[model samples]
Structure formats: C-alpha cells, structure tokens
Target: MPMPAQEIEELIRAGIPDAQVEITDLAGDGDHYSARVVAESFRGLPRVRQHQLVYEALGGRMGGALHALQLTTACPTEE
Candidate 1:
C-alpha cells in the first residue's frame, strides 16, 4: 500500500508538532511525492539532517508504503 498525502503530513506533524507541511503526489501513483516542511525544530539543523528527520518520521517506510520523496526543509521564518 502507498502512503496518502494526509498520512504523510500526519507523520511529519507527529515528528515535529509545529511543522508546516505541504505534500504533493509526484507520480499520481501515491509512491512518489514531494514535501515542503518548515518547522522550529529545523532551525539549527543542516539540510541533510532536516531530510533525515522527515524520513525518520515515516518510520522506515521509504521503500514500502512510501517510495520516493523529494523533500524541502526549512526553518520557520520569523513573523
């Protein structure tokens, strides 16, 4: 089974409660996706680390329910 966009968002929110996430299906197959996330937790992390956090949030689903994810991570902008 493939992961739904809402489910992906939920997983990311679970990882970073205050994260602002946008998810899109890239292939229309539910396996390939793109996600943009902004969160306070990512304020001091490197880009690689930020992506790692998102992958971890999926709980090792990278090759299963979730396949390819083109992810963009950023710290929350001051407002």
Candidate 2:
C-alpha cells in the first residue's frame, strides 16, 4: 500500500504548519517519491533532522506503505 502524495504532504504540513511542499512520484509508483519542502520550521534544524521530522510525520510508514522518498528540505528564503 503506497502512500498517496496528498497524504504525505498533509503530514508534513501538519508538522511544520507552514511548509511549501512539492511532491513527485519517482517510480510512477506511489511508493517511491521525491519531495521538496520549504518551511520556517527548518530554520534552526540540520538537514538530517529536518528529514527526520518529515519522516516522523509519516508515523512509521517509511518502510511499509512508503518505500522511498528523495527529499530536499530548506528554510524559506528571505525576500
């Protein structure tokens, strides 16, 4: 059971509140995805930690419903 892109985006937004996320299914299978997330919450966190936070938002679905995620996280840029 692959995770839906909307579900993954919802989870990330739930955790970060103000995340701007773009999701793509890399394998044409919902199980493999690529996500680019920009959030204010990432301002102080390391990239690894930011990724972990997003993974945690998935609630243990990483190895099961969600197979692989190529993620890019960043703090919102100053305008």
Off by over 4 Å in 1: none
TM-score for each candidate, following the candidate numbering: 0.92, 0.92
Error of 2 at 5 (Å): 0.8
Model 2: runs farther than 4 Å from truth? none
User: How far in Å is the alpha carbon of 34 misplaced in model 2?
Assistant: 0.3
Instruction: Report residue 42 deviation for candidate 2 (angstroms).
Output: 0.8
Q: The CA-based lDDT of model 1 is what? A: 0.91
Per-candidate total of colliding backbone pairs: 0, 0
Please give the TM-score that candidate 2 achieves against the real structure: 0.92
Clashing pairs in 2: none
